[model samples]
Target: MSDVTTPKRGRPGYDQAAILEIAVLAFNEYGYDATSMGVLASRLTLSKAAIYHHFSSKEELLQLALDHALGGLEGLLLEPGAATGAAIDRLAHVLRGAVHVLADRLPYVTLLLRVRGNTDVERQALTRRRAFDRAVATLVTAARDEGSLRADIDPAVVTRLLFGMVNSIAEWYRPTGPTDAAHLANDVLAVALNGLRTPA
Candidate 1:
């Protein structure tokens, strides 16, 4: 017998979850439009048939990845901290949760942020994102009503600014570095809740 052990496999043992993870990474690495089932198969070291066995088409993979990101965000709204608290505190909780979700699901969330409504999946993702934004805007409006946020700013504007700050992290955040998700969350909340301008 040869020293090397031969691999015995009919179809490579790949599951849908594992494939979705790699698919998200591939989409993040190569633009969604550029990443094809063939490219994914090559990346996963599987045949086109193997990939197709898990996903019907490349669009399915994209939809799954978008769902992963959007699911995490939508779940945040259901959390106790977000659901029941003072408006300001609840907004803070949501902001922190958003940062945590972004850090935890960086690649998926990054892919989500890059969607341009070019396809049905992208359009649905965009609609979900806008809904999440509206939910945050509702919190901002509540905070303003309670006098926790600056009176000069419109709640809609505040929502965009706060989320814009939080969402921008997906562009540059690295998981291996010194800062963790909690630290990032704190930093985001600090800058967002407290302005840079000093008292005159």
Candidate 2:
């Protein structure tokens, strides 16, 4: 009788989650337009068939990554700390939470920040990003109304500037290499809000 071997019980050493993680890195390092399923397969040591089995297309990966990053931030806005504090206090807490998300979800948010709306997937993401920024800007407006934020500048202008600094963290930030996001946030806000002031 000829010896025969049957296939393993299940797909081993690779799954949807693992594929997503690799995809996130790949997307971040090489912009989405340049990354291909074949390249991903080569990196993962899996066949094109295996990758197709997990995600239908690159767009799915983009959407899923955005969901992972934005989901955390969206949830942070609704927390009791955000809902029940002085406007400036709540805004600061929400901003701190945002810095954490930006650091921890660096890859996803990086992709999010670079999107230019060239494709349906990108346009959808851009829409969501605008909505999120608008909501956060509303909070800044509230803080200004409460006399906590500087009255010299427009709340909308300050909102964009503040978030521009926060969002730029993804570009050059190395979470393990040095300065954590919280300390960075404090320092940036200090220079921004205090403007070279020493303790009185």
Tens digits of lDDT, candidate 2, 94-190 = 7888888888777777878888998887888788778878878888888888998877878788889988888878878987967987887787667
Against the true structure, candidate 2 has what lDDT? 0.78
Clashes of each: 0, 0
Candidate 2: give the clashing pairs. Answer: none
Name model 1 segments beyond 4 Å from true.
Answer: 1-13, 196-200
The sequence of per-residue lDDT tens digits that candidate 1 reaches over residues 1-200 is: 01111123354665677778788888888898899888998998999998888778999888888888898889899999999979999999999999998998788889999999999989999999999999999999999889998889888988898888998998889999888999989888878886555645
- The candidate maximizing lDDT is 1
Q: Distance (Å) between predicted and true CA of 160, model 2?
A: 0.9
Candidate 2 deviation (Cα RMSD): 8.3
The alpha-carbon lDDT assigned to residue 162 of candidate 2 equals: 81
